[model samples]
Structure formats: C-alpha cells, structure tokens
Target: MPDPTDVEKARSQRRAWEQNELRDFLERQPESQQEYRSASGLPVQRVYTPEDIADTPFEDIGLPGQYPFLRGPYPTMYRARPWTMRQIAGFGTGPDTNGRFRYLIAQGQTGLSVDFDMPTLMGYDSDDPRSFGEVGREGVAIDTLDDMADLFDGIDLERISVSMTINPSAWILLAMYVALAKSRSLDLAKLSGTTQADILKEYIAQKEWIYPIRPSMRIVRDMIVYGAEHLPRYNPVNISGYHMSEAGATAIQELAFTIANGIAYVEQVAATGLAVDCFAPRLSFYFVAQADFFEEVAKFRAARRIWAKIMKQRFGARKPESMRLRFHCQTAAMTLTKAQPLNNIVRTAFEALSAVLGGAQSLHTNGLDEAYAIPSEMAMKVALRTQQIIAEETRITEVVDPLGGSYYVEAMTNEIEEAVNRILKEVEELGGAVAAIEAGYFQRGLADSAYTSARAQASGKRTVIGVNKYVEAPQKDAIEIHRNDPDVEARQIQRVKAVRASRDNSRVATLLDALAEQARNPSANLMPITIELVEARASMGEIVKRLREVFGSYAESPTF
Candidate 1:
C-alpha cells in the first residue's frame, strides 16, 4: 500500500495539474469528447493515480490465490497451465457436430462445448410437432441416448472436459451423458464436464424454461446433490451471466445477477441437508467478455472477490475451494457485426485477451463469421488459433494478474465491486433471485439497459465502428457463411424413431412411471431416476413430459 501522506501529496499535485496545465492544454487543443464514460455508463477519469485508490484497503486487493481473491482465484494463474481453450461447436445432427468436435480437438482445442438446437434445448423430440422444422437449425439435435452416443462417439470422456450449454432440459442431457459413460464402462467419478443447469438464469434472461421456478430449483438441487455424491469432478450447474450480458445487461449487472443466482443455488442446496463446502467447490460460472476491455477485466476480478466474501462471510464456507469463483469466459457474440464481418475477429481477439488477463479458467473465442451464421471450419480454426497465440506467443501468461497494482484497474475493480454489492442487496430485499424473477425485476432491468444502449448507439454516443462510426459501403459477400444441413431435421427424426422402435415400450413406460412417482415426492432426488430413464432408451422428451405432468410448467408475466 502507498503511504497516506504521499497519496495526499499526490492528490494535491494532481488537482494543481488539472486546474492549470490541463486547462491550458484543453483550451489550445480541445479533447475529443466533453466527458468520458465506460460501457457501463460510469465516469472514466482522464488519468488515474495512486490517490484514486487511496481509501481502498490493501487486504481487499491481496495477492493471487489469497482471500477475497481480487487479483485471481489461483496462486500461479496461467503459469502452471494455460486456460482451457474450449471453442463451442454444434450444428445439424449429433454425428455432424461430433465431426466438428473432433476437428477442434485435432486443432489443439483442450475442451469441448456443446451448443444444442432449440428443440433439444426445450426438451422436445425431433419428431414432436413443436420441434418440426427446428430440429437442427441453430445447433445439434440430441433426442435419445443414441444421439448422445453419436455426439461423443470416439471421444474419451475421462480424458477431456465437456460443457453442454443447455438449460431447460439440462438434466436430461446430463443423464444421457452419464448413461453414455456407463455404457463405455467408464468411471462416473473420473468424468469431468459441466451442465449449464442454471434454470434461474433461463427465467431471468434466456427465457428458455419449462418447469416453474420452485420445481426448476428443485431439479437443480437434485443435480448438485448427485454430483457431490457421485460425479465429484463434474460441475452440476454453471450459473451463467453470459445470456444476461447478451440480453443487454451492463457489466456490473451481469456480475451481480450471476453471483446472486449462485447464492440462491447455495441456499437451495443447503436446505437439502448438504454442507455448503461439499458442493460449492464444484459450482462453476460462465460469463461473457464484452467489448469494454478494462471494464470486462475489472468485472471478472470483482466477481472473484465478491463471491469469495459471500461464500465465506454469508454461507460460512470453510474450504478455500468453495470460496474460489472459477469461471469459463466466452467472447461476446452480441458485439459481432454483420456489416464488416471480418472485423469481428479483432473484436473477439480483444475480448479473449480480456478474459485471459482477468484469469479465466477456460475460454471460447467467437468465430469471425458468427455474425451471419454458425462458424465455418476456417473461422473456427481462426478463433482457436487466437487463444493459441495468446497462450504461446504472448508472454502475458508468464505472470499472474499482470495489471494487479495499476491505478486504473484497481480503482475500476473497487468501483465494480461496490456497484455489484449494491445490486446484490437489492436482490436480497426482493426475497432472492427466484422471487425477483417472478416479479420481473431482472427482466425489467435488462430491458431498460438494452433500450438505453440501443438509444446510445442510435445517437452516436456509443462508437460501434462498423455500425455507428467509421462506416463503410456495402460490398459483395467476401466470406462463405455456414449453412445447416437441409435434411438434418428428417435425419434426426428418423434416428429418434428408430431408437424408440428398438427399445421396449413397456419398460420405458414403467421407468417413466417410476420417475413421475419420484418427482411427485418433494424430497426425492430426481437424478438417479432420470439416469435410469435415459439408460432404458427413453427419449429426453418422454422424461421431461413425465416430470411436466408432476411439476406443471412455467409462464412468465409480461413486464413493460
């Protein structure tokens, strides 16, 4: 920490410089803008000094791996090992996406992230009427255990980490993954992966939920308990803020809302007679690294500090792992532009850099062509190489929290932490995340922020190069956009139908009945029965339908 007397002296000198020298300079050559502000609308001073963080306690900004974890969650950060480069890939049938997965691995991707189509994400079979024409449009379609097998055909589950970006039907996918591992004679405890079972965020921002909040929370609790007891290496729920950010939340809102959702999950799980330390250590987070480089970096730092304090002070967590807020970062897809599509590569690279500087555990760089469609093979390789260049070429990984003591970064970190704490308090007063979601608090906040951002862009307050500034004339298409397989829906439906025909209807019906009976029991853990249902060759839609009969469904109230 800097000496208080020196800080005071510096502050006095700074005021003098600003009053005389800066005033004269500005008069001679006016600044670009009247005032400068961050992407979150917070003021950004012309220059930062030690005086800016004079009031901040030294302990609050401790070394990496220490309590509060402002610098980072790990002691060595990227020194021991670089973050896992997990580029997301999914489109068309399970086999099709599996090809992409294999390609990414061959190109040096360390982990796999699955992106599911709308039908699969919504717990619908490819043959279902609601799933027609949408089976494999946006992402891969997985309806049965057979599809899960095809998706990970030759991949070694025990050796590689996989992440599934599914919400409403996340449990069904997780069950299929477990069933697949078992069929391969793999140890469940040795499998490491993540299921984005954050139903609360689905209700708050993503809007892709099935069961009501309480029932959905119950399902998430069941997964947490099961993972703690069985799949110890797996992260049961990746409480995510990425959707919220893409839906138009400020950086602070994303951090605060995500941590609040994490808190809600902890409370729900703790209510199930489980110790916080037992499962909290496996809880992970997902966030978006947006365009605001410094703000994004500060947001990640503040997230670790805030979560550590919340786990230790509020939840009585004793284990250091429980307090560590490990997260996976994805470069913001919303920032990608269709105008100058290739420019998205630069945007993604900078965002990926911010994630690395902020000490992300894992990262996914967006493909350059993602603004128009799913990434082509070439674009995916470029995105993967961006991380490779950062990890190998750039020497940034040699040090931990390279910007730890910067006056600007520390001040920004403190500001973001304070702002997030205020929002967390508001969430608590609203009776927690579920209650707030029901009251449309989060929805309203997101909508307002989105509107504000849109207005800013329209009025030229925000400088989105291709969209609002440095405009360029439209030209002929220069890059090929990825197109989904036109016959994917038919193929997926046929595969799902074949699986149903091969399985015994009587056994599937019996298993689903047992699952419904267990689901009706408030104290019953649904994971075991769900796993059994998947193993019996029952489709995901069948299992979800059975649970829906027992738990009903959710409908969000409209908010202006």
Candidate 2:
C-alpha cells in the first residue's frame, strides 16, 4: 500500500499537472473524442493513477486463489494447465455434427461445446411440423437417445468435457447424455461437462422458453440436486451472461443480472434441504468477451469478487470452492462484420486475449465467417488456432494475473464491483430475479441499453472498424459460408421415426405418465425419471409435451 502522506502529495502533483502541463498540451493538440466511455457507457478517465485506487483495500486485490478472489480462482491459473479450448461446433444431422466434432478434436481442441438447432432447443422432435425446414439449420438436431449416441459415438465421455448449449429443453438433453453414458457402461461420477440449463436467462434475454417461470425454476432445481448427488463432476447449470450480453446488456447489467440469477438458484436449491456447499462448487458461469479490452477484463475480475462475497456472506458458505466463480467465455459474435470478413479474425483475437487476462477457465473464439452463417470448417480451424497461438506463442500463461496490480485495472475492477452490488440490491428489493423478470425489469433494461448502443453507432459516436470507421468495400467470395445439408431434415425425421417404431410403446407411455405425476408433485427429483424415459426410447418431443401439459406454456408480456 502507498503511504498516506505520499499519496496526498502525488494527488496534489497530479492536480497541478492536470491544470498546467495537460491543459497546455490539450490546448495545442486536442484529443480525438470530446468524451470517452466504455462499451457499457461507463465514463473513462483521461488517465488513471494510484489516487484512483486509493480507497481499495490491499486484501481485496490480493494474490490469486485468495479470499474475494479478485485476481483469479486458482493459485496456478494457466501455468499448471491452460484454459480449455472449447470451440462450439454443431450443424445438420447428428452424424454430420459428429464428424465436425471429430474434426475439432483431431485439431487439438480440448473440450466439446454442442449447439442445438431450434427444434431440439425447443424440445420438439425433428419430425414435428413446427420443426420442418428448420431441422439442423442453426445446429445439430437430436430427437432421441440414438441421436445423442450418434453425436458422441467415437468420443470418450470420461475424458472430454462437453458443454451443451440448450435452455428450455436442457434437462431432456442432459437426460439423453446420461442415458447414452449408461448404455456404454460409464460411471456418472467421472463424467465432466456443463449444461446451459439457465432458464432464467431465456426469459430475461433469449426468449426461448417452454414452461412458465416458476415451474422452469423447479426443473432447474431438480437438475442441480441430482447432479450434486449423482454426477458430482458435471456442472448441472451454467448461469450465463453471454445471452444477455448478446441480447445487448451493458457490462454492469450483464454481471449484476447474472449474479442475481445465481443467487436465486442458490436460494431455490437450498430451500430443498440441501446444503449450499454440496452444489455450489459445481455451479459455473458463461460470459461474453466483448471488444472493450480493459472493461471486459475488469468485468470478469469483478464477477469473481462479487460472487465470492455473495457465497460467503449471503449464503454462509464455508468451503472455498463454494465461493469460487468459474466461467467459460466466448468472443462476442455480434461484433463480427460481413463487409471486410477477414477483419473478424483480429477482433476475435483481441477479445480472446482479454478473456485470458481476466482468468477464464475455458474459452470459445468466434469464427471469421460467423456473421454470414455457422462457421465453415476453415473458419473454425482459424478460430481454434487463435487460442493455440495465444497459449503457446504469447507466453501470457506463464504468469498468473499479469495485470493484477495495474492502477487502471484495479480501479476499474473496484468500480465494476460497486456497480454490480447496486444492481443486485435493486433486484433484491424487487423480490429477486424471477419477480424482476416478470415485472419486465431486466427486459426493459436490455432494450434501453440496446437502443442507446444502436443510436450511438448510427450517429457515429461509436466507431466499428470495418462497419463504420474504415469504410471498406464489400468483399466478394472472401470466405466460404457454411452450407446446411439439404437432406438433414429428412434424415433426422426418418431417424426419430425409426426409434419410435422400435421402442417399447407400453413402457414409454407408462414412463411418460409417471413423469407427469412426479412433475406435479413439485418436490420430486425429475432427473431419474427423465433419464429412464430417454432410455426407453421416448423422443424429446414426447417428454417435453408431457411436461408442457402439466407446466403449461409461457408467453411474455408485450408491455415491457
């Protein structure tokens, strides 16, 4: 810590310099912008000094793996092991995506991140009319356990960590994964992966939900308790800020709302007579690494500090693991531009670098051609190599929290943490995350921020390199756009139909009835029955339809 007398002396000197040398320099050669602000609209100072972080306690910014964990969650960070390189890949039929999965693994990718199409994500079978022409368009289509098997046919579940990006029907997909593992005689305790089963974010941002909010939270709670007792290594729910960020949340809103949601989950699960420590360790997060370099870094650091304090003070958690905030980051896909096409590579690289500096446990870099469609094979390879180059060539991982003590970074981290706490307090006053969502608080906040950002960009206040400032000519045939398989829908429909034909209809009907009965109880652990339903060859649509009959569908209010 700096001496108080010296700090005051430095502050006096800084004020004098600002009025004299700085003022004269600015008069001679003006700055680029009259006012500078972060992507989140936080005011950026002309220069940060020790006076900026004078009020921050030394212990709050202590060494890595310490309490409050502002530096990082682990002592070694990337030195003991590099962050998992998980490039999301899923398109067309299960087999088609399986090929891409194999391709990624062979290219030195360390983890699997699955992206599901609209049908699967909405809990519909590929053969459903609502799913026609949309099967496997955005991502892979999985309607049955057979599809899940095909998706991970050659991959070993025990060795690789798989992240499933689904929300509304996330538990069903998790069931399929567990059933597939059981069919192959694998131990559930040893399986490691994450499921984006954060239904709250769907209501708050993504708008891809099936059941009403309260019922959906019940299902999430069931999954958390089950994962705690059964699959200890698997992360049942990845409380995500990525969707909210992509949906146009500013950095402070993203962190605040995400932490608030996590608090809600912890409260709901703890109400089930389960100890916080039992399940909190496995609770994880997902965030987006945006273009604002320093702001994004500070966001991640503040995320850890805020979560640690919440777990320790609010929840009375005794274990260190319960307080640690582990997150996987993906580069902002919304920032990619189709005009220059190749410039996305540089954008993704910088975003990825910020994620590393902020201490992400795993990361996914967006491909160059993503602005047009799902990334092509070549584009994905380039994105994967981006992580490789950072890990092997950059030498950044050799040191832990390299920017830990920087004056600007420390000040920014403190400011972000304070801002997030204020938002969390507001959410609590509004009766928690679910109530806030129902009141359209989060939705309205997102809309307001998005509108502000769009207006800024349109008015030339915010400059996007290729899109706004550079004024580059549109390139033709600059990159290969990923084309969807025309027969993917047909093949997927046939596969689901075949599984239905071959399955035990009587057992499936009985299991679906049992599932409905248990779902009505409100306290029953649904994971076991859900797993059994998939094992009996029940389609995803059947399971979801049964639950929907009991839970009913959700329709967002338009007033917000």
Residue clash pairs of candidate 1? none
Candidate 2 displacement at residue 380 in angstroms: 0.4
Quote each prediction's TM-score: 0.98, 0.99
- Candidate 2 ranges with C-alpha deviation above 4 Å: none
Per-residue lDDT of candidate 2, residues 203-315 (tens digit): 99999999999999999999999999999999999999999999889999999999999999999999999999999999999999999999999999999999999999999
**Model 2 lDDT, residue 543, Cα:** 96
The worst-scoring run of ten residues by lDDT in candidate 2 lies at 1-10
Instruction: List CA RMSD, all candidates.
Output: 1.0, 1.0
The residue-by-residue lDDT of candidate 1 on 1-560, one tens digit each, is 67899898988999999999999999999999889889997789999998989988889899999898888888998999999999988989889999999999999999999999998899988899999888888889999989999999999999999999999899899989999999999999999989999999888888898899999999999999999999999999999999999988999999999999999999999999899999999999999999999999999999999999999999999999999999999999999998898899999999999999999999999989888888999999999999999999999999999988899999999999999999999999999998988888998999999899989989998889888998899777868989768899888889999998899899999989999888888899998888888888999898888888989998878554
C-alpha root-mean-square deviation, candidate 2: 1.0
| Candidate 2 TM-score, true structure as reference | 0.99
Candidate lDDT scores, in order, read: 0.92, 0.93
* Model 2 residue 222 distance off true place after TM-score fit, in angstroms: 0.6
